[model samples]
Target: MPRKFKVTVNNVDYDVDVLEIGAGSPQAMPSYTPIAAQIAPISSVPAAAMVAAAPSAKTGPAGAGDQCAQMGGVVVNIPVKQGHSVNEGDVVVELEAMKMKVPVIADRSGQVARILVAVGDGVENGQALLTIA
Candidate 1:
């Protein structure tokens, strides 16, 4: 047997049907199907609207020597400050994701021209962390 109930989520009301198991013999059990699969497809919906917009590429403020984050995480430490000298492969920023520390390395050897992110800041992939001149 299915019980109908009204549920509210984010101020939106939804009617749901829930079936209780073990109320009858195993042979009387009904096959389960997801609600989404049962809904009819809407051909009127535009394909572009169904797809999400991609994030835009970011560049350093100086327009060169930008060191971007490879993954999304919280900044745990900044090893280099603005005007500090750095070499290729040097760790410029450290991020913590999934309880693991990840180091952001410099791709070019130059002085740190700017630090775009600070310690305790959250960063996304491709976001500029610092720039080297």
Candidate 2:
């Protein structure tokens, strides 16, 4: 006998029939069939909309005094802006990776000189997020 199951993968839903085969049974194998009509189309959401809010300041090129990302991830928040005073170990940017939120801390105390990335931007390890001067 075949059992019907509804499965969702990557935001898409599918209806599939699954069969079971026992040892020493006459049937050599079990198969499954996915009903085309039951599948739900996957929808795309804009990256900017997925984040809490977009960065308010303009981003500039990387330069001296830049604070960098320690790991690759998507920018979730920017807690400091250009010209904002920050202290060493202060959280300046938040990143989301591997289903975890990571805080990017300031390496030195200084006024923010520049913002190099915005919320919803994907950053690589060691990439500059902002600059302290």
**Cα TM-score per model:** 0.63, 0.56
Mind giving the per-residue lDDT tens digits that candidate 1 earns over 2-115?
A: 999999999999999997667666856668999998876878667786665555545534356888888989999998989999999999999999999999988999999888
Q: Which ten residues in a row have the lowest lDDT in candidate 2?
A: 52-61
Report, for every candidate in turn, its global Cα lDDT versus the true structure: 0.86, 0.84
Worst 10-residue stretch by lDDT in candidate 1?
53-62
- State the displacement of the C-alpha of residue 1, model 1, in Å, after optimal TM-score superposition: 17
Measured with C-alpha atoms, the lDDT of residue 35 in candidate 2 is 83
**What are the runs in model 1 whose C-alpha is more than 4 Å off?**
1-24, 27-31, 34-47, 50-52, 56-62
Please give, for residues 6-91, the per-residue lDDT of candidate 2 as tens digits.
Answer: 99999999999998777878786556566865665535555667574644323345467888888889999999888899999999
In candidate 1, the residue pairs with backbone N, CA or C atoms under 3 Å apart (3 or more residues apart, or in different chains) clash, namely none
So what's the TM-score on candidate 1?
0.63
Residue 60 of model 2 has an lDDT of 45
lDDT value, residue 69 of candidate 1: 88
Deviation (Å) of 21 in candidate 1: 6.6
